[model samples]
Target chain A: MKDWRYWLAEQRGTLLAFGIFIVMFVIYTSNHPAGFTANVVQTAANKGVLLAFVAMAQTLVVITAGIDLSVGMIFLLTNCLASWLVVGTPMQTTLGVIAVLAVGLLCGAINGAIVIYGRLQPIVATIATGAVYYGIGLLLRPFPGGSVNEDLADAMTGRVFDVVPASLVVLLAIVLVIWVPFSRSVLGRAAYAAGSSETAAYMSGVPIRRGKFAAYTLAGLLAAIGGLFLTFFTYTGDAAYASGNAYTLFSIAAVVLGGVSLFGGKGSAIGAIFGALAFRTIGDLLFVFDFDPLWQPLFQGVILLVAVSLGAFALFRVRNRLEWFL
Target chain B: MSETTPMVGKSNGGIAGRMPKFIRRADPAVLTAFACIVLLLFLGSLYSRSFLSPEYLLQQLKVASFLGVIATGMMLVVLLGQIDLSVPWSVAAGAMMACAAAAYGPAGVVLAIPFGIFCGVLIGIVNGIGVAYLRIPSMIITLATNAVAQGLMVVYTGGFSPQDSATGAMRYLATGFAIPGVPNAVIIWALIGAAMVFVLTRTGFGRTVYGIGNRERAAYLSGIDTRRVVMIAFAVSGGLSAFGGVLLAGYASKAAQSMGDAYLLPSIAAVVLGGTSILGGRGSYLGTVAGVILITLLQSILSVMQMPEAGRQIIYGVVIVAMLLLYGRAPASR
Candidate 1:
């Protein structure tokens, strides 16, 4: 295959996921009572960004061929922390924001430390850490009532000049600032190499450990960003267990939908962002179509199953049965 | 070729020779779990005198039975190097369906157990087909299945609490003591555990599961029906999860939404804590039993201390990590 052809093949999953999201969004907007108006767009953006940020976080760890089950917990933990800290005057709020982000970084670091240095599997390590983060979150906001800096929350969650959603802009900015640089850097390539084949990466002298550690830490930061946005949106800190778990599950779905291979070493954060948007749209689509609200989980599951199954088409082409295990 | 063969044999012998005799004789995980249980018991005694009482300890045993049943199935899947994240809802579905069935009449009540188990079997088949045939990752497929089951149950209950109560038989099975002071739930768990131990140890099916987990291709090359094994493991996992749910419903007297949600992590934790390889193959039910007991006792103690749910979760996560660090660091023995 030509270079471009290989590139296209490489990006097929992301593109397909993107296509699915666009189609779903279009259908959703068209069927909505208000059509594609700013209000509708803003609401969708606000909801989608939260998942998109978290999905981006997931994409990082996933690209290293490891999963972080605690991303949702980190999101919850940060939101809980933000509720208490991001409430005072401007300087205090700034410090609070930094502290929350630092806490997220620390959470990610712990996960990375356990998985890498401790040589524990990513799944188990994250599950444990996720529990700890969630426990801390629960402790922080046991009653689910805390204030945020209202002015800051409203401005960030609100529209930018009454047109484009500010949250969307922030999401875009985050992509440019964090994801773009990381994806282009040496460490990012190392992460991809590690995900693709850790032994090969190590043999090639890739900084696999650092790359993976960076991926995990960045994942924490992204999840914290999501948490901040969540606090902004809800205007309070609630350590709802179900919601945390849902976000974790949904982020995985979005990652898969965005064409980021759960197997790792493939896919992009951008694709995952679209995947998150598309997943959010699926729920909204049901709402717009006047389906019973109770049917939402089933429909979402079905859609996710179908969407993920699309990625499985490649498996059928495998000539060796052994490849199936991989 | 002869020289290389001898060298390989010598190297293998040398490596084995370097290890202590006892290390080679026993699985370390079983011992660790045993120690942890003893330590937890000691800690519980330290915390409160009542905790060490037979009544309280038996209560913990009964609670462990619920997780034990689920972990038994989960161990099978984990042994195969796959997972069934659908457990949470499989459990809920089982409980809900069984309860709903019992509301019909005597025949419904009689069939309730089977009916609930069958619901789990159905979900298991779906999970199996997805993992074995469709070639999707079990983690993803089961997660999806869990959501689907949750959705179906929610719609079935019309978004309200389930109206059906546990059958008389179920309540008895969950809460009643059969041998005077022994909870029927514990007996049920023991029976299932025995069956599992037999299946995992005595049968060709057990050999195949270990073979597949160790290396599927090698197992398949050896003419073992790998896909069938995978399917069976998942089916068993689903069925077991549902069974656990049924017992839970009986214990609680009614099925509630998301009742199974709490079990997913703990089940996985128990399996791993028992010293089972999360990647698959090479584990024992005895180890898992110890793990279940330890976790149950820990939970009871924590609850007794009035630690909030969050604190308990933190400790739970910490304990899993600690166990993993202790056992999971070693490379898998092929």
Candidate 2:
């Protein structure tokens, strides 16, 4: 294949997911009573960005062939923490935000340490750490009553210059500042390399451990950002278990939809972000169609099933049955 | 013997001689589970005198049976190096279906158990078809199935709480004592466990599971009917999970919404804690039994200590991670 063709093939999943998001978003907005107004878009963007951040977080660890079940819990934990910390004076709010982000970073680091050094499987390790994070979060806001800095929350969630949603801008900024650098850097390449073939990467001196560690730690940071946004959107810190699990599940769905392989070594955060957005739009699409809210889970599942089934078409082409296991 | 053969035999014997016989002969996971059970019992007794009582202990056994049943099925899938995340909803669907069936006449009650298991079987087959035939990843497929099951249940219940209650037979199966001081649930679990043991140790099907887990390609090349094995494993797992849910409904006397939600992680935890390789193909029901017991005891102790739900969750997750680290780090035994 030509170089561009190879690149296009590699980017196909991401592009497809992006297209899905656009189509869904356009449908959603067109169906809305206000019809594609800035306010409606802002609300959608705000909701979509939270999952987008989490999906991005998921994308990082996934690229290294690991899954972090705790990302959602970390999102919850930081949300709970942010409610308590991101309040009062501007200086205090700034410090509180930093503290929440730092806590998220720390949580990710612990996950990395256990998975890489302790040699625990990522699924179980994160599930455990996720529980611990949730426990602390429960302790932090046992009754679900905490305050965040209102001004900061509004500024972060609201539209900028009366056009683009501020949350989308932040999401883009994160992509640029964090994702762009990491994906272009040595450690990031190492992560991709490790995910693709750890033995080969190790033989090639790819710093597999450090690369994976970075992926995990950065995943934590991204989840924390989601948590912060959750606080901003909800204006409260509730340790809601269902919501936490939902986000975790949705993030996985988004990752898969975005073209990031659950098997690892392929896909991108950009695709995951779009995947998240598209998934969120699925729910909104139901709302606009006046379906009973109770049907949302069923609808989401059916859509997910269809979307995922599309990926399975590739399997039919596999000549060897053994490749099925892989 | 040739000079090289003699030297190789001598070195092998030397290494064998230096290692402890017990370590070499026994599976470490079973031993660890046994130790943990003892430790948990000791701690439970220390925490509260009631914990040592026969009634309390038997009650714990009964409770453990629910998870035990589910974990048994989970182990089969794990043995195949795949997973069934659809367990939570499968359990729910089973309980709900059984309860709904019981709401009918006497005939419905008679068919309740089979009906519930059939529900699970149906879901399992769907999961299996997706995994075995469609070649989708089990994690995503099962997860999606779970969501679909949940949605169906919700729709069936008209978006409200389920209206049906467990029938007398269902209740008896979950709560009644067949032998003195032995709950029916425990009996059910034991029977299931025995059947699993027999199948795993004495049957070609069991060997196929291990073979597939170890290397599916090789297993297929050896003409093991790998797809059939995968489907059966998933079907068995789904049936067992549903049986567990039905029992749970009987125990609770009603099927509540999301009742199966709590079991998904614990089922995985019990199977993994029992020393089953999450990567598949190397574990025993005995270890799973021990794991189930230990977890039940630990839960009892934590509750006794007045630990909140959050604390219990944290502890549960921590213990699972601890067990994974302990066992996962070891080289695959077989």
Candidate 3:
């Protein structure tokens, strides 16, 4: 139980992020007299499904002290692959879906292979692969012209029931799937241990290489999920359109904002999701204000910086604040 | 390093005296970079006989020179353990400012290079302060600066490109071809590259920059003023990027607001391709020269091949991923 104290102390970023999210939700809900309708909640929840998934993938790799610069590129490739596969192909719909996921998984595996066997750094390797993958997608579809199956997109995007949005349901399902491995599994703890101290983690018998591989592999899978969402959301595959690489930095920011340390160790998947929601909520509200999109990048960068600064300040709780002066 | 290293090791044989060239093994990355360049060139040659012509090669050299000059500055910053993403816009800002200063005529022509360099240095200081003092990651801070700089360009140029026509030595810097067959821009880039190699290897500041990159805290603890070194590295980067802009203006016979656009990736690519560790601390300037040629060659090849723009970007990106993965993954910790 005493071990938990170190955790609570480390989680200031998570608390702050959640606090901000709740505040935004309250502000939006309170401003409208009717307040917090299913549609509004569904919209946020729907956005959350993909953002959180992508955020989780990025968070996992980042927590292992690596960055996947290629996640967006992978998403674009996967989305385009999925779109390309859907038209007049003899494969079953299930097989087609698998093929799309395979596109992402294959790319991720390539990333993993290079990162693991080739001894590449995550940032450099991913950036390079992303370019390649992006090129492949461009080759596949020089222009943005492809369609997702209407029925599948509709089903995937539709609300699960009257009370719960389908996207939220999917998100929860993903969370449930990850929770077991994340919390109870041996590999999971090793992931944290490896991130915390590679030498020590190795000395302590954590399979450092294997754990890192798993983390990246999982990140690849999760990025594919983001691609899957794009299939539903946009209802088309556009190679030229991007997952927006800024989101790569933003996801990192969200994780950092959620109080996940960039240097690895001490972070939570749930925290990342909340952080993403908090980030998106800010964007949503900003959109409501009708500010130009150009300002959004600058604004988001500022917010991310502030959030990190506050997190840094709170991490030391005045001790480092004094250290800054010293 | 290759010159001094083995001889130094022979004289001092004790444990502490044993030399460790940061490059411990025969690197596959250098080979990969070479292959990429060759492949691009081969494709270009296949695409058109003119691709191998001196006129075309010289033009390619001119392009390489501009980015190569900027890449040298970028490589230094990378050596210092940071990146300067604002170099793209900083180059643009330099061109625009130098073009604006052209109203001063012949004197302005000579002075434009320094003036552009000054804008870069000022921006570098701001970037340095953001990273070294305020401690924002160079990526985010420079991204903001990039946006701001570009936006400023939009406002200053009023969507029209800035034009400069320099008829004196300034034009000669970029336009005047050298002895035999070289374009002036190529000659200038080669001169700068050579000078940088000398500076990086011979100077105290250069050693300190590499030292600071290896471990900032350790350098500080060892009584090195890390902040000052970082500031200086960025200032140099700014100056070089500006110099590239100046030469670009001269070579083009006019300055455009977005002349620096193609430079961003290729500059970083050259640094990475050249075998400099993007993560800082373990690299060389000579590698940058190699990288510059490699990227320029590849770009020329692609352009000559006449592939679609998106395909070209993809090819470049994939090449980057390959290089990144094959070599130069930053280590897991500081």
lDDT digits (tens) for residues A1-326 of candidate 1: 79999989988877887898889888998999999999999999999999999999999999998999899999999999999999888999999999999998888888888888888878778878999999999999998889999999999988998999999999999999999999999999999999999988998899999999999999999999999999999989999987888898889889988988777899999999999999999878888989899898888878777767765444765788677765
State model 2's lDDT: 0.88
> Quick one: ranking by DockQ, best first?
1, 2, 3
Candidate 2 has a DockQ of 0.54
- Across B1-334, the per-residue lDDT of candidate 3 in tens digits comes to 3543554455445642543545323243554566667777777777788877788877777778888889999998889878887877788888778877767766776677778779888878877777777666676566556656665666567644445564355578887766767777888887888888788888888788888777776777777778888888887888888778877877777778668866877788899887778778767776777789888787666665577767787778777766675666645532
lDDT, candidate 1, at A161? 87
Candidate 3 deviant stretches above 4 angstroms = A1-7, A29-35, A86-91, A241-243, A292-294, A308-326, B3-51, B85-123, B134-184, B215-218, B242-262, B310-314, B317-334
lDDT of 2 by residue, A118-141 (tens): 887787678778888888889888
Collision count for each candidate, in order = 0, 0, 6
The global C-alpha lDDT for each of the candidates, from Candidate 1 onward, is: 0.88, 0.88, 0.73
lDDT of 2 at B46: 82
For candidate 3, the docking band is acceptable
**CAPRI-style class, candidate 1:** medium
Number of backbone clashes in candidate 2 = 0
Candidate 1: which stretches are off by over 4 Å? A1-10, A312-314, B1-24, B159-162, B330-334
